[model samples]
Target: MTVWDRPEPPARPVPLDRERIVAAAIALADEGGLEAVSLRKVAARLNAGPMRLYGYISAKQELFDLMTDEVYAEILPEERPCEWREALRVLAHRTRRAALRHEWLADLLGGRPSLGPNGLAVTEAKLAALHGLADIDTVLRAVETVSSYATGAIRREIASRRAERATGLSERDWQRASGAHVTRMLATGRFPALASAVHDGADVDAETTFATGLEWVLDAVAARLTRPPA
Candidate 1:
């Protein structure tokens, strides 16, 4: 065929790269949870053959790692706080917010080591926040403690949200009226403390509950810290 009759080489397939591949995978996961993401589906979204993705990612786990790191980028603050307490608090809150935005994140938050650039940057920020306050071991422990709390809390919050959506009721309402059996059990004198808390406790929103618990943990960390002399 003549040059004029050629099909223009199909536009170079839009220049596939790791970023585009990860973005497509993340979008798929966001829409349908982590189960929805696969190399074939990601390839289909990018209009490329499945084998073409192998150049950028060897397996699905690597794709997940990339997606997690990308979310970490979102978790990183534009301006981190200088004080250790506020800085740790910001990391926890921002991470929770990011998980809320990407519900699938709850599944993978602490599932694996985050060795990507953005993920390492987040770790660095947390460590830097407590740099001079204590020894390296103490600082590492503090960071781990805060991170563990944030991860567990985020997962629980997301699970609660999903339960709420599934049951068409708020968590408080669900707890209050789970069933006749639960009501009867609560009424029994055998579990007075549990019953009292169920009946008398304030039904706070999820944010309030998470914040209160986080502050309590931070307070515990503060108690353990060996603050340098002023």
Candidate 2:
């Protein structure tokens, strides 16, 4: 077919909504590091100019905010079960999954809260789940506690991954960190508690440490719930 007979190669559709642009940005961020995401990159992905992206998203920060909300939007919302422990367990797993799925999410999560509708929806869901606490102070503390745990877990995971990449170390090699080094220090038997703990096997695991801390926080929240109203 001649160039003109090709019927202009079928014009591709253009996205006109913020959701579409933000979705594109999310996909871009997922495949590449956050630094690889930019108006220019997104535009090129969409086969448009950088200025066209601004039409849908005002600034890169706005794009990031939208992407952040999109990640939170993945949180599954079920009416919190009757037991607070069950609710917390579900929420923690959901948050962990979202963070693990999106590598850039930990930083986005701890940054300024997004006021977008999707973000507000997630916040409202969390508040409602903790509404049984009835005390504003307790409720706020519970929210903050769980959120910090989730973010801290994700942050540690990311840091560990980065450290491994930088040092060309694998998990097997990771044991070398406090392995022989700390083990030898404890082997001196200067402190009975240290010796006992080392003999009992005191290996550190990111997942185990995270779950232990999360369980402790939830237990604290449960204690607060049972406390008599002042």
Which predicted model would earn the best TM-score?
Answer: 1
Q: Name model 1 segments beyond 4 Å from true.
A: 1-14, 176-179, 227-230
User: What's the CA error at residue 166 for candidate 1, in Å?
Assistant: 3.2
> After superposition, which runs of candidate 2 have C-alpha atoms over 4 Å from their true positions?
1-13, 78-80, 177-180, 183-199, 202-205
* TM-score per candidate: 0.89, 0.81
Q: For model 1, what is the C-alpha lDDT against the true structure?
A: 0.86
Q: What is the lDDT of residue 162 in candidate 2?
A: 72
Instruction: Give the Å error, residue 64, model 2.
Output: 0.7
lDDT of 1 at 124: 98
| Candidate 1 C-alpha lDDT tens digits along 8-49 | 222255678787889999999888899999999999999999
Error of 1 at 135 (Å): 1.0
Clashes of each: 0, 0
